[model samples]
Target: MVLVSAVRDYISRMLQDISGMKVLILDSHTVSIVSVAYSQSELLQKEVFLVELVDSISKSRESMSHLKAVYFLAPTSENIQYLRRHLVAPRFGEYHLFFSNILKDTQIHILADSDEHEVVQQLQEFYADFVASDPYHFTLNMPSNHIYMLPAVVDHSNLQRFSDRVVDGIAAVFLALKRRPVIRYQRTSDIAKRIAQETAVSTVVYSK
Candidate 1:
């Protein structure tokens, strides 16, 4: 099976176990992730009637405790903040969190810390971190394209962000295949080398 298919299977398993009407809540990045692989029609088939961004969903005070919320989002700080706010005043009957990649212990602690209402039911890593634009190829879809041309000293944090996303994409590819790969990056390309190293390091850590 392909990377996209693996992620699809993980999602299918996540939703199939939960019976009844569901609302698929996604973060800004995951909208494309779920939309491309799982269409609106397909989601409807699975009884998912609503698709809303996490931030926007939190803004509306309208309570819809009738529907179960399945959250597929990156384990980003902003998403965590949004989850914290929602736990205080939950609109859905239950919440199932599926992070695209490995979540930090601090992140899990934050979610647990915020979940005083005990609305969150599950937390898992589904490994659909990259946007699958086509069957053979995928893109990290990093927002800042200009980072590669600049030196690391110019913007250390942005460079880290760019590298982290690329590494995440590469890790998702291998995790989907369920295989350990020996990946190489262009030596001349600083960004590629850094990303490759980070990917290898993260893969080792995760696999262990």
Candidate 2:
């Protein structure tokens, strides 16, 4: 399936299922995922008035009991922690949680414990972890993606852990902002040469 359409459809289905004013919550990655396929105006049409980051939402204690909270977050520990905090306090009238990928049993248990108010109406998994830039283009949306080019395997491993992400059947994209390394350094590293090769491969493949 085309990445853009798949993600867009998933989001549309998620919003349409519930009726009322909604506060759309997202994580760092899902921000790119939704923003790429959906616009601010589009969300407004779907009754989404507020778009907040999981990390940032913890700062405010204001109650929004009038709005329904529709959380579209990645299944990560940090994001889960933020959700837990929100659940305990019970700001919104109702909570509809949707994860971008599979949620672990432990994660669910943690949420179950935090939801003392019983505000969470539904929980679901909609697997669209990567951002869909266009019908033909998509990305992992990793900010520190350049770490993949480090000489040691540990650097790549750490970045993977930070993002709680993995990749397969993919290349070149593992190394984003390819030109950064070339322009930043006067001398080419081993990985720098590999970047050139990937660029050549991409050009050749697209030309066909």
Candidate 3:
């Protein structure tokens, strides 16, 4: 229940203060992040009338000035690009940007610069990046699950990306709880050890 409660609290905080009809914009990854902790009926109760993928949200050229956009997405380059396009020709009256994990300074700068229309009202990091399957079990839902089993030498770039994401997920879990944990991993697995060490560094960095 820890993971579920933490994610639910984050979602509640995001929606509770915002009034009027809202359109929730999620990425492919955040769909799982939200679905695990919330339901469509709960969103409707919060006055969220629409749920849409960031990539698909702009497919319609129609303006929706009555509905505000509440975007909860991972801070990825592709998602950033999609946001840039949306900002250029905004369909919603207001945007509340909430990233699932910590975002780079440059990424924030890029977003701020792109918002020429001043449609964006708020920018925040809520740290509900991983999928909570159960109270004691959570998953990053990594696409390259097989890559983690391979040696770091093979496809070094992808290996590093995988490790970084692992660290991010772990850091986000701790951040959501407002705690900094000393991460431990199995001694037999090099990947686990690497993830733990990186997570420690990331946790410290993000805590500040």
Candidate 4:
């Protein structure tokens, strides 16, 4: 029920089922997610021989067909595209894909089409998508946390991105814990109101 333990358990489940030497792959965001709860030594003890970024792994021409690829990535379009390219030219014996959040149906179809060789052993949404600071607290780790104080018009795109990250982070937390939150935010703050509204929509979108 605690934040760190929940994240740790999800990661344990992801790695424990797949046997043998494996390469743990992570995206920029997922690196934070995993690093907070799972240590490098823990990964090595689990038979993880290597850890590489999603964008970095695709650039290597050398094949690791002897190793099973264990991917822990955020379910973003860019990450999916990188994965699709890897699937098109599989370099591993088997691929176990675990997304940090829900994967849309269209995204699934794209992956299906790109997987011509069908080396993908599994594809699932594990939902360990937030950075847990401790047992009781978590964070999205947004550097632009200050933007919520400024009006949205000051920097529209950055504010939008910030809000979206908040929504995603909130929804991911609820999804990971399998709980529906009863949200209450400050009614006076426009930014808090905006986030509460977006979280409502996003939680609904991802919960199903």
Clashes of each: 0, 0, 1, 0
Candidate 3 lDDT, tens digit per residue, 132-160? Answer: 99886899997658767755557778778
Candidate 1 worst ten-residue window by lDDT: 146-155
Give one digit per residue, the lDDT tens place, for model 2 in 11-84.
99889988999999888878888998899999999999999988888898989999999999888899889989
Say which candidate scores most in lDDT: 3
Q: Which residue pairs show backbone clashes in model 2? A: none
The count of residue-pair clashes in candidate 4 stands at 0
lDDT of 3: 0.90
Candidate 1 error regions (>4 Å): 143-146, 149-153
2 or 4: which has the higher TM-score? 4
Model-by-model lDDT, in order?
0.82, 0.74, 0.90, 0.87
Q: By TM-score, highest first, what's the ranking?
A: 3, 1, 4, 2
| lDDT by residue (tens digit), candidate 4, 1-208 | 3889889988898899899999999998999989989899999889998999998888897988999999999888999899998998899999999998878899999999998998998998976879998988998878758756755456778777777778888888888787888889988778788889988887776777
lDDT over C-alpha atoms for residue 161 of model 2: 61
For candidate 4, the per-residue lDDT at 203 reads 76
Q: Which pairs clash inside model 3?
A: 1-135
| Per-model C-alpha RMSD | 1.7, 8.6, 1.6, 1.8
Tens digits of per-residue lDDT for model 1, 1-208: 3756876787797788878899898988888877778877888888998889998888799989999999999989888899888888888999988888888899899888888889899989867888877776777777667656555546678777767777887888777767787988778778878887888887777777
